[model samples]
Target: MPVFNNKDITLHYATFGDKDKPALLFSNSLGTSYQMWQPQIDVLQNAYFIICYDTRGHGQSSAPKGPYSIEQLGQDVIDLLEHLDINKAFFCGISMGGMTGQWLAINHPERFHHLMLCNTAAKIGNEAAWLERAQLVRAQGLKPIADTAASRWFTPSFIENNPAVIKQLSDTLAAGSPEGYASCCEALAKADTREQLKNIEVAITVLAGEQDPITTVSDGQYMVDRIANARLATIDASHISNIEQTQVFNQLIQQYLV
Candidate 1:
């Protein structure tokens, strides 16, 4: 267990590449852990100092109760970077991770060299809905959501063609702690980055999935329009755009990183 103390929590993380190179940090979506970004790690490891970690509670990390704010999550990332003594990095996050990236840009501008946010929104769902999700997940395990999870995470074709991958992902969730999953959902439901987005003056690239049912393209466009130097790139995949279309997504990210 590669763990680092973040004061409030101990984070279970996976680190790759080397310290001398530019760093790339990836954040996964809700109900998912850093393992969700393993594919990206495989691709980016050679060129960047890659950091991927399970948020407190979800994967191999310790789980706490009740609620956690997005700012706290962003701060955790900063703490991790400080733990490693990384001055700057290339940050990319999907969905909840994207929100974290936005928060980081607002409060910890010096931590990143470049930013890429995919399948994310400035304001996630309202608080009531998020709290409800947390409550339900606490009552039931992740299995109940497995079949329907794809509706929000991946398109039909991707799910149908990649049964093995989907099964593995579903299994990952099925085994996840209900408390941890629900707590993150609560964090998302109450998270609204709209007011704070103006504070993010860093250059950013927003990647939206055209077929994404969760955070639609409009959400991505909104971020692009709001953030001063932010640009939007729309892909044909669903919420997990990078997974569905890695070739195009990876190439675009590489171009943006350059």
Candidate 2:
């Protein structure tokens, strides 16, 4: 676990594959860390410079109390890229990370050659809803709200077949810093990339899970319709579809990259 200082925050990062090849940076969801992309890392690293890191307050990264905006989160990516001297690369993000990708592509379109957006939306949900949820979590704790969140993130059938996977991912939510998680939840509530989505002219792959309850296929469809050259694919899992359906998720992403 190597750490990079971006002045404001230190990012905990790890890499795999050839450094000479074009890079692929993985930005994770609100409750997740870099490890969420484990399924893709092993397969894609050989061909691409694969980098994954915990965001400002998630995983092993330093947690700075923030009422952070989407642009600020996007700047975190920019800061890290400059730190590593990475001028251009492919950008991939999931959920909260996907929101950051929207920011990256909009703010630094020239820096990204392609985009991979998984289980995310331009506007996740209304501000009132997320703020309410944040307040509830802050007052009641994550475990009390975990079951409801799990249901929204995974399918009922998935919940039946893979209890252990659900439990593991849910546990990650439990370990999350309340302040960090709540702030991100608030970010999602206020996030609106509709105008920015229209501005994205680069090739983008909007991948979603057919069974995803959080960011629905409908959300991905909106992205596909908005971005000029965006293509859409539907996997057979939930919000954390890549980990939930590794082989299928990896294959779809691999095909997109090729």
Candidate 3:
């Protein structure tokens, strides 16, 4: 349970596999913890030194006040890597983490070898929708949105078939801190990296879930089109494709990183 104290915020991080191997940092989606990456870690750990962390305001990390910025979220990753003495690593992030990955490759390209952005967009949803959702979460709780979110996370067929997995993921979402979740919502609301995508000159791979309602395959294409040396990889799953299609997801990532 290593904690990287980044001034106002504290990030909880974990590492796996051999320290000598090339590093591959996995950043999870919004409202989920580092545990969300377990499926990939189970297989890819042998080839790469895997690093996963609970983003600020989620899963054992500090939940500061509302209205967080994308730069703030991106800085957390930078600080964590610096604290661990990691100079550079391949970054793989999904959803909100993908948004963070965009900022990293754009603002700090020197710190990464490659970027893997999954199930995310340069500009997610409209600011109004995100602000409204944040307001709703602050007023009520994450439980109200948890079920609907779960639906968007996985396909209906997968949800129906994997009852235990759905419950586990949904429960994790429901248990998130309201302030933390809302703060991230604020970050998403203000985030619009469409203009900055062209500036990212790093080798990048953009992944999208075929059935993802949150961020569709078209969104991934938009990123691939903007970045200079980038390509697209489509997964036959929903938003949380890593969990719904673990084997395929793991294989794609391992292939790309190598």
Candidate 4:
């Protein structure tokens, strides 16, 4: 349990493979811990030094107060890099993590070599919906969201075939801190990078899920179109494509690193 203190929060992160290898940092999606990247770490660890961290308010990380901002999330990454004594690394993020990646690319372009944004959007759902969800989570805790998360996170077939995996993730979500989850919801509510996408100059790859209802392929394309040095790649999965299609996702990431 490697933890680093950043301002008001303590972030938990794990690293794998040789330190001399090229560093590849992973940021998990909302409601997931750094364990969500295990599938990727299993495959890429031999080649790259893989770093995975639980974002503030999730997993082992401390959930401070309400309404975390995207800038705060982005700054956390910068702080982590400095703590590790690494000047730069390749970055990958999903959903809310992807939004953080976008903010980093725009604000700290010099600190990364390449960025992969998966199953995310420049502007996720409307602010009202996010705020309402935050309120609901605060009132009733994570059970309601956990109950409905499968439908949004995985395709019907994947959910049916991968019951164990789905259960583990849902259970993690159900057991998570309500305040932490709600605070992240508030962050997503205010995180809109649609106008700022064009300013990102770092090389980028947008990994879209063909059947993601939450953040559609069109959203990925919207990002690819706006970012100066970005391209789109599609996989036949839903929101959590990396878990749904691990081999293909790993291959794509390896190819991008090459």
Per-residue lDDT tens digits for candidate 1, residues 1-258, read 589977778899888988787888888877788988777878888888898988766788877775778877888898888888888888889888898899888888877877999899998777888888788778877788765777678888888899887888788888888888887887787788788777788889999999987788999988888888889999999998878898888888788975
- Where model 3 places Cα greater than 4 Å from the true spot, the runs are none
Order of models, best TM-score first? 4, 3, 1, 2
TM-score for each candidate, following the candidate numbering: 0.96, 0.94, 0.98, 0.99
The best candidate by TM-score is 4
Tell me each candidate's RMSD, in Å, in order. 1.2, 1.5, 0.8, 0.6
Clashes of 3: 0
TM-score of 4: 0.99
Residue clash pairs of candidate 4: none
Model 3 alpha-carbon miss at residue 21, Å: 0.3
lDDT string, candidate 4, 1-258, tens digits: 799987899999999999899999999999999899999999899999999999999999999988889999999999999999889899999999999999999999999999999999999999899999999999999999999999999999999999999999999999998989999999999999999998989999999999999999999999999999999999999999999999999999999965
Q: Which runs of model 4 end up more than 4 angstroms from their true locations? A: none
Q: For model 2, give the 10-residue run with minimal summed lDDT.
A: 141-150
- In model 3, how large is the Cα lDDT of residue 247? 95
lDDT of 2: 0.84
Residue 198 shift from truth in candidate 2, angstroms: 1.3
- Give the alpha-carbon lDDT of every model: 0.84, 0.84, 0.92, 0.94
Worst 10 residues of 1 by lDDT: 145-154
* Model 1, C-alpha of 24: deviation from truth (Å): 0.6
Q: What is the lDDT of candidate 1?
A: 0.84
